[model samples]
Target: MKRRDFILTAAAASGALALSPVAATAAPMVFTPGVVAKELAAGKTVFLDFKASWCSTCAAQERVIAALKAANPAYEQNISFVDVDWDDYGRHEFTKSLNIPRRSTLVVLKGDQELGRIVAQTGESEIKALMDTALNAATM
Candidate 1:
């Protein structure tokens, strides 16, 4: 193979590897119309991530969330993480009922109460705190 071709292939391989974590990470359930209500009724803490594929803020928050969950397995073990694709459900009543202002919103709900929320915020600490809240509520 040509030197240039070899370099390009190496770079592409590295890029793919870097993205493997996001792919390999346990994915949250895609939100269906009544999934949230069902989970909440079952006494599970729900972590709702309202995101769009094209949103950079959502991507950032996802990275932070993935890292946090990897660091602490309890978050995933205790909470039900659901991905609400903004493109699909952004205008749906479920979102409107929650008053989600926009994509990149992260909400933690337990029972009939909202435990915590973060909107368009991607700081590691902030995301971790929200996860912690969900964990606490889940274990309570």
Candidate 2:
């Protein structure tokens, strides 16, 4: 290939790679209440995202969590994420059990114990702090 053409192709490929979702982020697996129960029973750390599709705060939190996971794969691996779709399942039994007050609640739990929580918070630092609480509990 000509040098100019090769350079242009390489740059395009690099841009595509940089913009790829698989390269930029690692999304946590979605979990149901049953899975949360099982994981908790097995002494796993859990990050429960109580969210609604219409809630912008929830989307912000999701982005923060995704970024955090992408940054710290080792820490993320020791935790499980459960996205409770409050838009559809807001009134479910697990919501009642957790006493989740709204659509933007993020509950951190280690086993049957509550570690930390955030309600309608979008700050990345705050979300990371909340997640750190669960990770700390897991190590204890």
Candidate 3:
């Protein structure tokens, strides 16, 4: 498939070719797994990354995540990183699952309470801050 000129907003996703129930159906983005929920309930911290394949911001964030993961093995071990596919990812259902109307939404949840959410922005520093916050929450 041709790369989209730009990452589409969740509003634009209803018309996304990949999201078509006809041509194809995308898998939902799962930032945190069931285990994460359980761990968080047990006082663990979890970081869920809601992203898409066509989103340029997601691609850039991937680099930052790689570096972060490499820099801190403890972060990798202590925190659970869940990558939820946003684009074409099970339209409507997944959208509702997020309870949000947009893609590129990064949410940090301490158990069930959300610490922070980043939407429609690609600032690495800000994203890093949110991730850091989530990691801290898991331990707290």
| TM-score for each candidate, following the candidate numbering | 0.83, 0.81, 0.63
In TM-score terms, candidate 3 sits at 0.63
**Alpha-carbon RMSD of each model:** 4.2, 3.2, 13.6
Question: What is candidate 3's CA lDDT for residue 101?
Answer: 55
- Please give the distance, in angstroms, between residue 23's alpha carbon in candidate 2 and its true position after superposition: 3.7
Tell me how far the alpha carbon of residue 32 in candidate 3 is from the true structure, in angstroms, after superposition. Answer: 8.9
Clashes of 1: 0
Please give the lDDT score at residue 22 for candidate 1: 50
Instruction: Identify the leading candidate in terms of TM-score.
Output: 1
Task: Give lDDT tens digits, candidate 3, residues 1-140.
Answer: 33463445544775676554333422223543354557567776666666778878777776666666556555665666667666544264544765755667777767557788887667768877877887677555
Across 37-125, the per-residue lDDT of candidate 2 in tens digits comes to 88888988988898888888888988888877777765566778778888677898888888999999999988667888989999999
lDDT of 1 by residue, 65-96 (tens): 99888777788889999999999999999999
Clash pairs (backbone) in predicted model 3: 26-88, 29-84, 29-85, 30-84, 45-138
Clashes of each: 0, 0, 5
Q: Rate the local accuracy (lDDT) of all candidates.
A: 0.93, 0.82, 0.63
